[model samples]
Target: MPIVQVEMLEGHTLAKKRLMVEKVTEAIVESLGVPADKVTIIIRDMSKENFSKAGKLACDQ
Candidate 1:
Protein backbone atom coordinates (compact mmCIF):
# COMPACT_ATOMS: atom_id res chain seq x y z
CA MET A 1 0.00 0.00 0.00
CA PRO A 2 1.13 3.54 -0.76
CA ILE A 3 0.24 6.56 1.34
CA VAL A 4 -0.11 10.03 -0.13
CA GLN A 5 -0.77 13.24 1.73
CA VAL A 6 -1.99 16.57 0.39
CA GLU A 7 -2.66 19.77 2.29
CA MET A 8 -4.34 22.90 0.97
CA LEU A 9 -6.25 25.92 2.15
CA GLU A 10 -9.91 25.28 2.73
CA GLY A 11 -12.58 26.41 0.24
CA HIS A 12 -12.81 23.69 -2.38
CA THR A 13 -16.14 22.06 -3.18
CA LEU A 14 -16.82 18.38 -2.61
CA ALA A 15 -16.88 17.73 -6.34
CA LYS A 16 -13.40 19.13 -6.76
CA LYS A 17 -12.03 17.14 -3.87
CA ARG A 18 -13.60 13.96 -5.19
CA LEU A 19 -12.13 14.48 -8.64
CA MET A 20 -8.74 15.24 -7.14
CA VAL A 21 -8.77 12.04 -5.10
CA GLU A 22 -9.89 10.00 -8.06
CA LYS A 23 -7.08 11.25 -10.25
CA VAL A 24 -4.56 10.84 -7.48
CA THR A 25 -5.67 7.28 -6.88
CA GLU A 26 -5.43 6.50 -10.56
CA ALA A 27 -1.90 7.86 -10.74
CA ILE A 28 -0.81 5.93 -7.70
CA VAL A 29 -2.38 2.72 -9.00
CA GLU A 30 -0.68 3.07 -12.36
CA SER A 31 2.71 4.08 -11.00
CA LEU A 32 2.98 1.49 -8.24
CA GLY A 33 0.99 -1.24 -9.95
CA VAL A 34 -1.25 -1.38 -6.91
CA PRO A 35 -5.01 -1.71 -6.68
CA ALA A 36 -6.95 1.52 -6.22
CA ASP A 37 -8.46 0.10 -3.06
CA LYS A 38 -5.01 -0.41 -1.62
CA VAL A 39 -3.91 3.20 -2.10
CA THR A 40 -4.30 5.51 0.90
CA ILE A 41 -4.81 9.24 0.50
CA ILE A 42 -4.96 11.90 3.18
CA ILE A 43 -6.32 15.34 2.36
CA ARG A 44 -5.95 18.11 4.89
CA ASP A 45 -8.02 21.26 4.66
CA MET A 46 -6.52 24.13 6.60
CA SER A 47 -7.73 27.60 7.32
CA LYS A 48 -6.03 30.46 5.50
CA GLU A 49 -4.80 31.72 8.84
CA ASN A 50 -2.99 28.48 9.36
CA PHE A 51 -1.06 28.68 6.12
CA SER A 52 1.60 31.18 5.15
CA LYS A 53 3.75 32.17 2.18
CA ALA A 54 6.44 34.80 1.58
CA GLY A 55 6.47 35.61 5.28
CA LYS A 56 2.82 36.49 5.20
CA LEU A 57 -0.28 34.56 6.22
CA ALA A 58 -2.55 33.42 3.44
CA CYS A 59 -5.46 35.08 5.15
CA ASP A 60 -3.68 38.41 4.87
CA GLN A 61 -3.10 38.12 1.16
Candidate 2:
Protein backbone atom coordinates (compact mmCIF):
# COMPACT_ATOMS: atom_id res chain seq x y z
CA MET A 1 0.00 0.00 0.00
CA PRO A 2 1.15 3.53 -0.72
CA ILE A 3 0.15 6.57 1.33
CA VAL A 4 0.58 9.99 -0.23
CA GLN A 5 0.29 13.19 1.78
CA VAL A 6 -0.04 16.56 0.02
CA GLU A 7 0.07 19.77 2.05
CA MET A 8 -0.53 23.18 0.56
CA LEU A 9 -2.15 26.57 1.11
CA GLU A 10 -5.94 26.26 1.05
CA GLY A 11 -7.22 27.35 -2.34
CA HIS A 12 -7.71 24.59 -4.85
CA THR A 13 -10.67 23.54 -6.95
CA LEU A 14 -12.16 20.10 -6.48
CA ALA A 15 -11.24 19.17 -10.04
CA LYS A 16 -7.60 19.98 -9.42
CA LYS A 17 -7.43 17.86 -6.29
CA ARG A 18 -9.18 15.02 -8.02
CA LEU A 19 -6.76 15.13 -10.91
CA MET A 20 -3.81 15.17 -8.54
CA VAL A 21 -5.09 12.18 -6.64
CA GLU A 22 -5.74 10.25 -9.81
CA LYS A 23 -2.30 11.02 -11.25
CA VAL A 24 -0.50 10.26 -8.00
CA THR A 25 -2.33 7.00 -7.54
CA GLU A 26 -1.52 5.95 -11.10
CA ALA A 27 2.14 6.75 -10.57
CA ILE A 28 2.29 4.83 -7.33
CA VAL A 29 0.60 1.85 -8.86
CA GLU A 30 2.90 1.88 -11.89
CA SER A 31 6.16 2.54 -10.06
CA LEU A 32 5.65 0.61 -6.83
CA GLY A 33 3.37 -2.12 -8.11
CA VAL A 34 0.71 -1.12 -5.63
CA PRO A 35 -2.93 -1.89 -6.29
CA ALA A 36 -5.15 1.07 -7.09
CA ASP A 37 -7.40 0.16 -4.20
CA LYS A 38 -4.43 0.01 -1.85
CA VAL A 39 -3.28 3.53 -2.60
CA THR A 40 -4.36 6.28 -0.22
CA ILE A 41 -3.98 9.99 -0.80
CA ILE A 42 -4.44 12.67 1.85
CA ILE A 43 -4.73 16.34 1.08
CA ARG A 44 -4.03 18.78 3.90
CA ASP A 45 -5.08 22.39 3.52
CA MET A 46 -3.40 25.08 5.60
CA SER A 47 -4.54 28.65 6.03
CA LYS A 48 -2.37 31.46 4.78
CA GLU A 49 -1.92 32.69 8.33
CA ASN A 50 -0.45 29.34 9.24
CA PHE A 51 2.22 29.54 6.52
CA SER A 52 5.09 31.87 5.71
CA LYS A 53 7.63 32.74 3.03
CA ALA A 54 10.62 35.03 2.55
CA GLY A 55 10.68 35.86 6.27
CA LYS A 56 7.11 37.09 6.20
CA LEU A 57 3.80 35.73 7.29
CA ALA A 58 1.71 34.64 4.33
CA CYS A 59 -1.42 36.32 5.70
CA ASP A 60 0.28 39.43 6.93
CA GLN A 61 2.93 41.96 6.10
Candidate 3:
Protein backbone atom coordinates (compact mmCIF):
# COMPACT_ATOMS: atom_id res chain seq x y z
CA MET A 1 0.00 0.00 0.00
CA PRO A 2 1.20 3.49 -0.83
CA ILE A 3 0.01 6.72 0.74
CA VAL A 4 0.47 9.84 -1.33
CA GLN A 5 -0.20 13.37 -0.17
CA VAL A 6 -0.62 16.33 -2.51
CA GLU A 7 -1.19 19.92 -1.48
CA MET A 8 -2.14 22.77 -3.76
CA LEU A 9 -3.74 26.17 -3.83
CA GLU A 10 -7.52 26.08 -4.08
CA GLY A 11 -9.56 26.48 -7.27
CA HIS A 12 -8.48 23.57 -9.40
CA THR A 13 -11.15 22.21 -11.76
CA LEU A 14 -12.59 18.75 -11.21
CA ALA A 15 -11.18 17.62 -14.53
CA LYS A 16 -7.66 18.60 -13.55
CA LYS A 17 -7.92 16.92 -10.19
CA ARG A 18 -9.32 13.79 -11.80
CA LEU A 19 -6.47 13.65 -14.29
CA MET A 20 -3.93 14.19 -11.53
CA VAL A 21 -5.30 11.28 -9.52
CA GLU A 22 -5.39 9.05 -12.54
CA LYS A 23 -1.77 9.73 -13.39
CA VAL A 24 -0.62 9.48 -9.83
CA THR A 25 -2.37 6.16 -9.39
CA GLU A 26 -0.85 4.85 -12.57
CA ALA A 27 2.64 5.81 -11.44
CA ILE A 28 2.16 4.23 -8.07
CA VAL A 29 0.80 1.06 -9.58
CA GLU A 30 3.72 0.86 -12.00
CA SER A 31 6.41 1.60 -9.42
CA LEU A 32 5.13 -0.23 -6.34
CA GLY A 33 3.14 -2.97 -8.02
CA VAL A 34 0.30 -2.15 -5.71
CA PRO A 35 -3.34 -2.70 -6.48
CA ALA A 36 -5.20 0.44 -7.40
CA ASP A 37 -7.73 -0.18 -4.67
CA LYS A 38 -4.97 -0.37 -2.07
CA VAL A 39 -3.38 2.92 -2.94
CA THR A 40 -4.39 5.92 -0.85
CA ILE A 41 -4.27 9.48 -2.17
CA ILE A 42 -4.83 12.51 0.00
CA ILE A 43 -5.29 15.91 -1.58
CA ARG A 44 -5.33 19.05 0.52
CA ASP A 45 -6.48 22.33 -0.85
CA MET A 46 -5.55 25.65 0.73
CA SER A 47 -6.05 29.27 -0.05
CA LYS A 48 -3.15 31.33 -1.44
CA GLU A 49 -3.18 33.27 1.81
CA ASN A 50 -2.30 30.09 3.65
CA PHE A 51 1.08 29.87 1.95
CA SER A 52 4.02 32.26 2.09
CA LYS A 53 7.13 32.82 0.05
CA ALA A 54 10.05 35.21 0.47
CA GLY A 55 8.36 36.58 3.58
CA LYS A 56 5.28 37.48 1.62
CA LEU A 57 1.94 35.72 1.42
CA ALA A 58 1.29 33.95 -1.85
CA CYS A 59 -1.98 35.83 -2.22
CA ASP A 60 -0.08 39.09 -2.22
CA GLN A 61 2.21 38.12 -5.03
lDDT of 1: 0.94
Better of 1 and 2 by lDDT: 1
> What is candidate 2's lDDT per residue for 5-58, written digit by digit as tens?
999889999999999999989999999987999999999999988888898888
Alpha-carbon RMSD of each model: 0.9, 1.6, 1.0
Candidate 2: misplaced stretches above 4 Å? none
User: Per-residue lDDT for 34 in model 1?
Assistant: 95
- Candidate 1 residues lying further than 4 Å off, grouped into runs, are none
Residue pairs in clash, model 3: none
Model 1 backbone overlap count: 0
Candidate that beats the other on TM-score, 2 or 3, i.e. the better one? 3
> How many backbone clashes does every candidate have?
0, 0, 0
- 8: Cα error in model 2, Å: 1.1
lDDT of 3 by residue, 4-50 (tens): 99999999999999999999999999988989998889999989989
Q: What is the lDDT of residue 6 in candidate 2?
A: 92
Error of 2 at 19 (Å): 0.5
